[model samples]
Target chain A: SKSNEPPPAPPVVHYYMNNLTNTRTPIENSETVLILTPLAKFYQEYWDNLLKISYPHDLVSLGFIIPKTKEGNAAYSELQAQVTKTQSGPKTKRFASITILRQDTESPLQSQSEAERHKMENQKVRRAAMAKARNSLLFTTMGPTTSWVLWLDADIIEFPPTMIQDLAAYDVPIIAPNCFQRFYNEEEKKNDIRGYDFNNWIDSPTARDMASKMGKDDILLEGYAEMATYRSLMSKMYDPQADPGTKVKLDGVGGAALLVKAEVHRDGAMFPPFAFYHLIETEGFAKMANRLNWESFGLPNYLVYHYNE
Target chain B: SKSNEPPPAPPVVHYYMNNLTNTRTPIENSETVLILTPLAKFYQEYWDNLLKISYPHDLVSLGFIIPKTKEGNAAYSELQAQVTKTQSGPKTKRFASITILRQDTESPLQSQSEAERHKMENQKVRRAAMAKARNSLLFTTMGPTTSWVLWLDADIIEFPPTMIQDLAAYDVPIIAPNCFQRFYNEEEKKNDIRGYDFNNWIDSPTARDMASKMGKDDILLEGYAEMATYRSLMSKMYDPQADPGTKVKLDGVGGAALLVKAEVHRDGAMFPPFAFYHLIETEGFAKMANRLNWESFGLPNYLVYHYNE
Candidate 1:
């Protein structure tokens, strides 16, 4: 039988950053940080931050560009200029040099009719962009210097400097910081404010009796509390006697602000190839953890306000 | 490893005729036969036939009288008289003594109140009848008699007189004859002569395909041709890629006709308590045969028409 015991922690922290438009201010000790961006604007923003933070660390910023068509070559001339700008700078002697990487693009189908051709070309562009980000993350982590890889979404803004340290405190194989909906209150608070009079939705007397049996502590959070109340009032709900809880253990947690250990990636853990974007990574991570018998937990006490709007 | 080989055949055929009524019947000379009955009308009709058939067998007619309620003592006394009459008969002198049995009136509920109560009552009656017959058959076959036990439905009328000999020819542990619906090709011939397309009545195209695949040769009679076609079509519909040439084994044949070796009964091969009616009995028999890894097949060539109308 495989051991369910947790693995030991790694020594260093490695952050894997993906950029869409432009980067924010960078951290100190740049050698410890690896910034991966696609747009030229993002590279310029990082260059500004490099001057500002002035910390002694290695920095590798890979600027990815997809060629327009199969006939067109992926020109590194534009990326080479950005690389020259960073290396030839006054603080160049501090840490490792910044490298600009461009992903090669295959041509979209040219034979199809104009409408069909446009749609296919658009699809090819999106796939190439995704492939670039996934491959870059994989390649950087494959090196010996990397320990843990932190995935930061392209649009995140207000994250604390000690965010990495907070994640490290868990010492668990996989840790995810609580990414709260910035404007929304917790579920319990929302339920309290609603103050609905009627208890249960279903009118079964037996259900009403069961609902009376529930203690206040069992109410959980707001939306969940209402759901539990409704179920308690509905006698026709699934019998508690039938739920023998010895299966896969999971309460509930979302996959944003996730921090994964190096060993998980070394064991060939990968995101599932799904067409949909949001839940694909989350589900893949959960399934991988289950397969490897790794424990995963979310720290609700440590919340991150994601400023997407 | 358990033996997958079929059992060798017995030398003699054993027949158990269950008289499903209360009238006393004189039986003589037969090695062993159990006649089970509950009502009186059916008992009188088969008395003479029972006497003639029992000539080469040791026969025992078992009767059961059910009380109206737990408080009714008069009903119990009446049951005793009915059982005593058959046991004292002169014709039964050369055969095993007749026995009577009754279900406990005050037994606790063993089935669900809604659907299982009716089913449980029917099973109780049938099991009591079968158990008494099994005990008598075992007793007669033990002493100076080489016999096999055949279980026959009490309402069976169209059985051929040479049914025993036909069953005896099989060099297997059990023999089951092919059963057909009483009504034959009359409706089909009338429809065909009238130039009516009866095929339209079959709603599912798959069912029609199945009927055609089984073919006329595989079907014993014209009436059952549709059913054979349906079975063939249904199998294909479930798994289209499955091999068409492979023969699919059925769970159970209908219980209109059944024959078993006496030793099987003697060695405690009694019918399970669940099968009260023909459908249930057939299902139970099939399940038991499957558990023992015994081969059970319908004799396709010889068909018995069970007349219900």
Candidate 2:
């Protein structure tokens, strides 16, 4: 009879999606998916597609719309009107599953220069909103559960309804799916996409060699593909199999989409706010998993399409 | 036309000490002193006396002794009789002014064990009589003809004689003194002397150390005391002052007495015979002067007393 017998377990599944303002169909299980997004008219089509998806999991969606100061209270009224209109849908079980969250108008961006300071501030705002939605969903759900938390970018479309089932087959703490480019055109295909991909993956040897020659203020986008290849090579050198039970060193995983164990978030393994936008968020999560000796896998088989516009 | 230019000068100094036998004293005009002793009789006594004195300048004395095996021959008889019957009195001019040379009966004890080896052998039975005598004196006299050399031993009296003044006064090739020793009872004053007179000098701590510890199986008695001290100290450390113009490192010095030029015995130095009695002679000579950049000196201040039993 210990006094602290751990807080009662939360829901087994939680989903967080960003910017769900202009969608039509409501998510069937509103308690499963947790969404965090900036409120904007351009996200309408993307939000509608998410609503139509047959996601049989809990969902928590949030919208961040900073009202313009010049527009005064008009902007606030418009945001509330749009949110309410989206909620007023067909009286189906799926429609009842959706939840709408709006940002307070007082939280508007003060200055453009301030917003341009660094990518970190923008990521902080997004990560804070997502965390709030995740906690709210967990608090409302009941029972002891080994929940799964799935994060999806706002503009993507979900494929087969069994996608979640396929992901659950692996009993790992974290899993990353291989993503394909959504807009694969003939011209793009003729341009040797693999070569382009290789270029993206392989760092320019010259650039890397001459890095010492660069000015201090020069901005560099280090090639992620090269980093991945190096990590893979180094892992093989340590152990060819890259076994989950064996210790593996990894730089990071990509952040476009990731599925994590719900307990990891509840246990304070939440994504760091500082890295919310930049690639560092993925790296930080990987580092945390390494510290805990938790397993993370990259599912080269499972494919997802990323729309890069 | 000039294929032969004095045959490139002999690397070793070779003197004919046997020729000086008729002339008991050194030639009046001679710049170098050549003393010869027969190894069979008084090798130990000869060197022991050279240690006590400090000579004036850079004077070297080379000691030569006929090998003990020569005592078995007919020639040994003539030499032995001549030395014993000879008296220290005024005679011919050549004998009157010449330096002293002492020779003893060849010893058979040389072939025996250490305890009996110190005594003189029967001169009438010496083996290889003439050859042994020639080589012994040859090796000793060779020291003078070069830039410098000295040969003396056998019942020598007081040292630091005018020989040092004569040698140092000139920039000539070689020089050595007629050494002497004093013998007096403990109760007698310094000037009072008993009837006995000994040729050998008192042994220095360094000479004792070298003869006992450093020489081991070698013919230690054939080494000079002062030279042995300098040699032992030089072996321990490089002294810029004592070894001013030399670069040779010596293991030890011959106790029988020595002084030599740098370039005298230049044919790869002397050979170590490895025999117990003859070992130190060549080894000591080579170490002190034959090696590259070597110069030698002997000090002659005190004297040794030769006791007659």
Candidate 3:
């Protein structure tokens, strides 16, 4: 359980998103933005990170999905209070709109066989729920003017306030930045960085074979990396590569921080709440998008830092 | 698990809800009706019962809360097909709108101690999740014109199409119909009438004491009823009573066919996703409502029959 894992390393600035030299165009030509996040924890940090986004508040809409619990309720109420105060204040900074929704999370079971089955079901169902949630938020809020949708996780601790502008410069239908979490390497006696979000990766023959032997309810995701083989996560490939401008083709995308053209979703690309081609949820979403003619790519050198536990 | 309980007897029709004699009044004076159902099964029967409602097609909005799973996805898809088909077939057969949502169910554990703790968490978290899902739906969909909200389960099979009208006729702020499920007694070889939703009940001093003595994380809702006293489900009282027009005061309420005035929710009353005064979820909602000056009552004579499993 990485419960004894070292603390996060200091934040690093490794610029990599798109090579668009003209960052001004992104802000000027910015279409209506809908920022959607499904949150379970890290409330304070999540709100602070949100405020750091460089996008203009008037053109951006904020959507939060807080799962049901005492903690979640507290977060929702507190966020509401903060938003209300900000809206009524003299600075005149206000979002286009804000919507808060509620959901629930199940505690993971502890057992061998039963836990394995529970793990599979939990993974499948949780992703499906997230996909359903993302879809619900997207469809309900997407208006005629919405040009892009950005998916962000609540636990992202570090990103340039201009992260939105950087992704917008790429002009991709679906794209994700390299994700890394800084951790103190006790052996090295110093904080070191490691690629964390590996959900987006190139498939390999070994992975296909491993996935093939699984049962109807079984899945071969990143957590099973020890048993499965994959070519590389974009973050890993980006770290040692010479070319930072090139985008890596990906078969899947994570919600950690992703930018998508609103049309891809409007055209019926969605995260399947059930397994599709042995992939479920977000990965299933990547499959669904590819089937619907949307190409997905990742910026390996361009990075976002996930909050290390 | 009430697995060995006696069979439910023949269906009883106690005339209730708003008298349909002036059925047109219900349609004309319809308060933007929102029928909320949290579903995991009985897809076909649910849709059939939904379609059978005599309320004006244009005034009634259908909301189904589906928990995340492969099975739930199938049900969601099936219901979508049914809704689309019904919507496109005739203008007279359309609901005002239909919204389907997703949540997750917790897996029961295997060990004795862990299972007990899991049981406590399951009861608290599952009901809390329901409360959260219910609140999300209510807040998201409650329009300025919405005057009433009806809570129904998906498995209920027997009810007059004018059931909504009947419940609305009661014209109370919060009211619950008696719930009964039919079961076959193998020993008696005869079907018996039994009330199944004992979640709605009157609190007793004995049960309250037991609940208080228990840990904050512990509850004695349904399964623990055998071990704890102080609360008795209205279903138990209804079965033995012969009166035709009797109403019982309740400190708790279930979603199995309930009618609530919109103001109660608008005025800051909600289904507390956590325990309130030893009650959780829907019951907590009942307590919250009473605290807000809204009275809760259930008709012991007027009944709704659930499909026997």
Candidate 4:
């Protein structure tokens, strides 16, 4: 019986892996970075721009979350086709790995059409749902080897190819880029660019005065004429003649493109679904970080373009 | 003297390399592949599509040659910007290496305007210069470790991500894919697709008869009524219901997306800039391969899209 037994099996070897001891800052390519994107609509341009990133693929991980709805299902199918085509090839053609999730909790505004979803009446519920989605994707995909986390929006269609390296080079606890968009200029008869995200800004005396008068359950919004906060927005700070590395301190941040050190998130910085210091979502995350004694920053001259629609 | 002598230098290490003893058929990922592209005009779509390829980047080498002309110089500058953005980051963000050459010999028609470049009278001269460019790029970049060579065109905008693996799976000495383009259909009020490259085809009795009657200096042109070859073009063989792997024997080949075993080129197969058997350029290259007893094959159903302009 012993003589007739089969030989022992051979060991399998894996060639690609994140460094197990990677606990350093993510300024170097040796440290792994996690990119988290919350998807509502899957645009081909967004996928194309993602592929255009010049960061090393082996050092980056991707995570996505789609809401549970009819439109969400269609987006998932389209996303699957791209993922399969990208990951089914040789080891070098794929990212470190990809993780996708469906939201566990459904939003009350999930059934609203695109035209109605952006109304002022729906902003509170819509943003709360998005905050939960980001936390779900972040907590589920991040691991000990992940030294950095980048929150990239799915609708961002254009950015510099060296986005990750440029953002991480600052080595700040957290940083946000000035987001802008291109539009047709009827008066000039040509295309023109304008600031898009008003969420990133420095605190103003008028904003603090307004927050002091607001109720505990109230939420503050940026760029609203009805609620004049008079904050200096980072979007308005873009100077083409200035150095791209120009930096500024910020009390609020936007979700379009935010880079954070893994330690900041580990210390409990998160996008709060409820009103925190009269702010919610990305601004709430900034408030939480400040409460933990970690400062937020912005690159006024380093620009990223958002989808016009 | 002994006290003043410098200590012995430390040894260096290299992480990426082609298999040194690799002489097998190149159907496996372990073998190295060299991609050669002769550039006249630089199209961003072509570069983007090249990046979308799912093949292993570490196992592939890239070669390019730009002509010496105003248009060529502008294209080179545009290409260099993209290359620096891609290759200046981490090691994984770059190809194995890129070798770019400035074509030594200038073409007589290099100064022709875009409108006059494709006239019937200029076809022979234009294509001959293109052939020379291809030969220069190929011979310079391919080395002993290279197991395969892919001749790609700069204007080809789209193809399957698995193109390299799919074409190599056939293990044929030389193979090409059917090239098509998208055009506006005036009658249908919609975008329509049609074959673009008519070079890849099978020999016919009529074509052979015409070749026999041609002078040594005369060049035969395909898809031209004045010089009808009556060949069965691979472009005309596309069938929606047919399998993508369907293959057919080919007597002529196109340079848009051609794949060849390294041994074929090593054995003296090349694009003839002058008339050979009444054919020139890619068609002449196919004729040369036939003389060496190597058959050319085409994937009738596997299609690649080219830029219309």
* Clashes per model (N, Cα, C within 3 A): 28, 81, 16, 0
Tens-digit per-residue lDDT, A66-108, candidate 3: 6555655666677777667655654436676666555433323
Model 4's CAPRI class?
A: incorrect
Instruction: Report the number of the highest-lDDT candidate.
Output: 4
Best by TM-score: 3
Count: clashes, candidate 1? 28
Candidate 2, A78-114: lDDT as tens digits? 5445445554544231222222222222333343332
Sorted on lDDT, best first, the list reads 4, 3, 1, 2
Rank the models by TM-score, top first: 3, 4, 2, 1
lDDT of 4 by residue, A1-309 (tens): 112111121111111111222232344547677888988778888887777777777777787877777877788878878877776665565677666665545656865554576666787888777876776566445543466788999888888877888887887889999998889999999999999888899999999998889986688889778888999999989999988789999999998999887656644466766676788889988986785568999999988888876
True contacts kept of each: 0.00, 0.00, 0.00, 0.00
**What TM-score, over all chains together, does every model reach?**
0.28, 0.30, 0.48, 0.47
Output the lDDT of residue B268, model 4. Answer: 50
For model 2, state the Cα shift of residue A276 in Å: 12
The residue-by-residue lDDT of candidate 2 on B35-102, one tens digit each, is 33433444333343333223311122333343325432333344334333332222221111111122
Identify the CAPRI category of the predicted complex in candidate 1.
incorrect
Stretch of 10 with least lDDT, candidate 3 chain A:
A9-18
RMSD of 1: 30.8
Q: Which portions of model 1 miss their true places by more than 4 Å? A: A1-309, B1-48, B59-95, B105-146, B179-255, B266-268, B273-280, B300-309
